[model samples]
Target: MRRFRHFTSSDSTSEINISPLIDVVFILLIFFIVTTVFVDEAGVEVNKPRAASSEDLEKNAILIAVTANGRVYQGGRNIGVGGVRSVIAALLEGDEEMPVIIQGDADANHGTIVKVIDAAKIAGAKSVSLATVK
Candidate 1:
């Protein structure tokens, strides 16, 4: 006589797949890169006044540059003194709290800087500051 035996065994394993998570991360990275805002540089040449303890200011500002020749510039474009009021008014029309920064050349006339400040104030700017290099 022969005896037969039957045996059964079960194997269990657990693992986590992270490939989908990695794909989602990459997609988010691409989306942010495409929608990110880039700040444009002010192309005008300005010889900023130097200060002993000048600090960096917020980049979200309206820059009004006064060259040594007494020319006024808004974002590097020549906007004459007569246009200063209008330009500043237009810029502050939507955001009255926008800050106005005057970048005056070291050799620029003091009166010109004063005029710029006055125009900015009349244009409804909440704050006005001078730009200086340290």
Candidate 2:
């Protein structure tokens, strides 16, 4: 007598196909990363005033800057002193809650900073703040 053995034409394996799931996860991650928006920097060289009591500000502010040479900037654009009102007004036209922050260089003229602050106020910015370093 000969021993008998079982054989099948089709082979079966118990394995889960997770390649599509992983691809979907990576796609979602890429979508989120592409859609996310971070705080936009003013993109200007500034010498912020130092303060032991300095505090962090919430993100998503309209950043303006006053340089040591009395140059005014909004998002790195040279908006002259006389242009602050119009430029800031345009920026705040439809956005009611967009806060304004002025980052004044330590050596910047105090009067210039004051003027910039005043302009921001005139532009209907309810919350205006100054930027400083610790």
Candidate 3:
């Protein structure tokens, strides 16, 4: 005669409830998304001029780029000098205090850079600044 016994431990069947953990993760994701600060990028890359007194400006700004060939760019498109005003104006529609940062290439014509600045100012931007490498 032989006797066989089967036993199941309650601990072996217990599962960790991860619903709360998933909720926590979702909450954190939402928090980061809500608090994240996004920067407006200039569409073109430029060789920025060096500056002795260049200081950090606000992160969220209207970035306009001036290339070495005297082309103006914003959000990766060639806006040119004439498009600068309309672009800036549309971007600043809600925030009047939004700054305009011009990233001018070292070889870009000074006059072209000046025209971009003037256009930004005319678009009603309160703070217009030149972006330079320190």
Candidate 4:
């Protein structure tokens, strides 16, 4: 006499699918990046004078800086007095109504500031505002 035996086993493992989670994370990243508002900086720091009647200006305007040594700067580069007109004009090519804001140091020469203003005006700036600390 002879005997034979046969056995069969079945086991299944399940895993958590993270594809949806990854997709959601990517969507959130894109949403934050699209909603972020970037601001333009003047690239130079000046000792802005205090003003009693200073008002808040728009964040999307062009910024120019004049150092205490009467040197003109735009975006951290020394553009000089003669370069103001050309730079401003180039910036205002498409947006003629954009306002120009000047940040003059507390000890900056008044004449240099005036010249900057004049150049900005000639460059077709709709409005020019002085930056001051409140």
What does candidate 1's lDDT look like per residue over 64-116, in tens digits?
88989999988778888888889889988877877888888899999999998
Question: What are the models' TM-scores?
Answer: 0.71, 0.77, 0.87, 0.81
For residues 23-78, could you state the per-residue lDDT of candidate 3 as single tens digits?
A: 99999999999999987689788999899999997468889999999999999999
> lDDT per residue, candidate 2, 1-134, as tens digits?
99999787576867999999999999999999999878866768899988888777765788888889999887778987888888878878778788888889999999999998898898888889889997
Per-model root-mean-square deviation over C-alphas: 5.1, 3.2, 4.0, 4.1
C-alpha lDDT of all candidate models, in order: 0.84, 0.86, 0.92, 0.91
Q: Write the per-residue lDDT of candidate 4 for residues 43-121, one digit (tens) a residue.
A: 8889999999999965577788999998898988899999999999998998888899999999999999999999999
| Least accurate 10 contiguous residues by lDDT in model 4 | 5-14
lDDT (0-100) at residue 80 of candidate 2? 76
Q: Find the candidate with the highest lDDT and give its number.
A: 3
**Candidate 2's C-alpha lDDT?**
0.86
lDDT of 3: 0.92
Which residue pairs does candidate 3 place in steric collision?
A: 43-76
**Per-residue lDDT for 88 in model 3?**
95
